[model samples]
Target: MSIVSLSSGEPTCTTEDVKAIAGANGFTITPGSVDETAFLLFANAFDATCEAIENLPEYEDPRLKPVIVDGERQCHRPDAVENPLNAWAHKTTLTIPSAKGPLAGRTIAVKDNVSVAGLPLGLGCSPGLLKDGKHPISPIDAIVVQRILAAGGTIKGTATCENLSMFAVSYTSHSGVVHNAWQPGYATGGSSSGCAALVSIGDVEEARQSGKDTRDYPLGEGVDLAVGGDQGGSIRLPAAYSGIYGLKPTHGLIPYTGIAALNPLIDHTGPMTRTVEDAALMLGVMAGYDGIDPRMTPESPMPDKVPDYARDLQAWIAGKEKAGEWTADGAAKGLRIGILKEAFDVIGLDPAVADVVKAAAERFRSLGADVNEISIPLHKHGAAIWTIAARPMMPHFVAGNPPDLLSHTMPHLQPNKIGQDYFDTLAHRNPAAVNILMNAAHLQLKYGPALARKAHMHVWELRDAYDKALEECDVLLTPCNNTVAPKHPASTAKTEDNPDGCSERIMDLFEPAIGNTLNTCSFNVTGHPAMSMPVGWGKVKEGDGRLPIGMQVVAKRWDEASILKVAKSWEVGGRWTDSR
Candidate 1:
């Protein structure tokens, strides 16, 4: 029995076409052979099916439907004068005027890679990569954007991200370099660079005004909070470098629908804020299954069943106050803290940073928490496992063919095809992005899928290792960045001496980010919730000033509550900067 019937109207496939296809796949077709005839029929059926499907009306998720506003979507690109840090990709005001919820009166900045209907989503790449050299306007809001509006949060604009959201330093964004909130001509960390800058700039200004010993930097307007995306320390790195709080919640805890993804296995979007409470408040609204992102597993909570993180934290504090347990000396009472030994032992770790983070971790003991060092030997190899497991998927993802997990996909954002323009632009703007594409291809050609499969299997073992270690402690601690933010690398500009503007040597471009994510990326693959909270300050590697140092707090999967409680306790004990 024939699965697809031959019809007079079926598209005809020639013998040459069959031969070309076979030859592309390292095979040859014989004329008039049975195999050639079978290939012809298969080609015709494929063409017919593709045409039929293309003709069918496209399906859009009702949940992702754009929310109508009374007026046009007001937005504009800020000039360098108006945007000194180059933090904002586009500035706009978006909110439901009549809506009221936990985020009422809060102004938020969304990372540019996430969707914001009617605004151009740059993805931090050069304009050449986009269709017609212009960024695509998102037709629907991302899940996090929708939740922010529903919670009465007013979105101020889209923050800039690194090119293709690939780099850790701030200079790679196509728009321009995102300067640190504390200093100009220095990095803010990345790929969520702009989010960290927007959230921290206001606090930095306030500190300067209060007679604090800090350098003066002209910063434009900043938002109250920001929604930052993370894959291998994007959220936490920027937050740490910018002196803010960035949380990468457990995988599947928050829906990732309508957001641009590097790989579904590691994509996450969460809150970047100045205070722990704000992160908790934002998480309460954004964390829940949307029934659209396939990343949401059975472990994900239902919408109505999600925890009231803000309220619960307040209640916990209130209980402590009533019982005379809210004193600074006892805030962390009964909590257990473990400093991951390998995290501090990584190469390039600054002694100043290690001292700051270690001192901060020990402060929990003074607040009545039991703190100790625990060793996880596998932690040293976590980044390798994470890279191997996720690298093989990048080439396919960049080609707009992500894994078919039955999840809702944004076809408009997917590129039609990658060509020379993409490679040339990406190479000049961010050599790291080009390296990823080439590395994935090389790995596939050399070791095959088995290498990725083995890496994926090791992901489970890595998760188990963390889980076992976490059982002995409430939260694990580490230094988020090995040192304070480094200065931005020279921009790739066309010049007489440097004609192409980009360095031919990959090391010239890749050296700054060598160990940036060493301490933070492991938990991303393990699916453990981790946060970067500013704990102190450290001297910049090449500059004559200080930059913020953040300590990472990690908790077992789905146990964000513990992480929050621990952070809040440390925050209440005293100001982080005082540790300096």
Candidate 2:
């Protein structure tokens, strides 16, 4: 099967264009080719994308290719638009007031789960027929979104969020999967998938040949910034899979004012970008207090007008350069990084991914900060507390009484069509599905103090253990997934039987007891800032090409600045420079 060329902006790619770009970029996108080496090299050169194809190499192996439809030599490709709305509207801008003078040139993508008045707040679900004729309006902007706009950052549009922001992959109850722009064939890791996708895809090419504004840069300006919410691994997963920098900041570090709630104790809104410094500038703008969010911590609001985090980041880079820790060109000389050996191995990850992550760890060690192998025992129970606390609330939010769903209506009421349809299918399969779901709702009625007690105990233990581990290191590193981007399933639609399977796989990868909660959930639960940065490319079975690998860096709570400093150091080290 051949790919359609996207170089012409005829709304989709054409076979001939795909072939031409593939050849020029040193790879092939044909089905059944298993072109791993070519794919990795191609992915490495994505930033310099051909007249129209930057980053296509990120997922360029044979495994990355989708199975050919009908096994025929087709000349034309599908012209379907993945998330066509009533109208695309003009891609506009929203300015955020910032203490850093002004974020004049920066651009950002806000997750639909984070409310910005007027735009549909579909958290990817259908609200059903509304009794009230009035549409939902966000009384105020979600603190994070407001902060970004205030900083002079221009808003593109709301990026799609997963079903009620429940799942890890980004498809919502409204939009289906947001394909990874880095590697067209793999999953973009959800809930925050759209933000990562738009940022990675950057802007449309002027024409295919000039190659001046390669597909990698967003609108040909400053770094692309993305703001998203994570109750589980939403932000981290997509950022990692997309080979970008994504941070799940300490819980409550930023106000959640208009954002939807998943697990209040764990829910957090954060930033994603191609670089850590960009992430920092976003955080600096968005972090602070607003009385509207009862969850906001009283930390003096960190100054309503904070200086440009970019300047601080630049200074840090300069210091590293002067100290010979890193070259001015972005290669680190010496840095200390620790591998969560136990955490990385528990997921039954692909050997190639494991190898690449290990190689990255070794590279940091060679550059000279202390390197250590360590384990966080409490990580074992992470998934349990997560499910016990999170699952019971599913029915309530997914299909409970009207108010419960409406409470989080703005920005993310129902984000994905697949997710909503999935729920509808479950309801149709067994008329009792709705009743069963309602019974499982997260109301304290059933979960009360008894369940809360159990959850609290486990959480306390885990938090205590996490704090101890952080005391021993500046940051902890681990793989984003057990394998590279999992093959994008033939479709995101889920039958009742398959509903929990995908979510389960993600949970288990991050934590067994809690299942699929490995690398990300722990951070969300612990309320610490964790950043997922793409490091290298690797192969996976069924992934004909190389998939990007993400290194998860976790820091102590509210110490986002430190995490950014370290991540910037890594970024300047040339790890992602070649990630293209």
Best by TM-score: 1
- Supply the global lDDT for candidate 1: 0.87
List model 2 lDDT by residue over 504-528, tens digit each: 3332222211223466786766687
TM-score of each: 0.96, 0.70
What TM-score does candidate 1 reach?
0.96
The whole-model lDDT of each prediction reads 0.87, 0.58
Compared with the true structure, what per-residue lDDT tens digits does model 1 show for residues 52-165?
Answer: 778887677888988765367879999978898889999998888888899999999999998889898899986677656678888889989989998899999999999889
Q: Show where candidate 1 strays beyond 4 Å.
A: 1-12, 213-215, 492-505
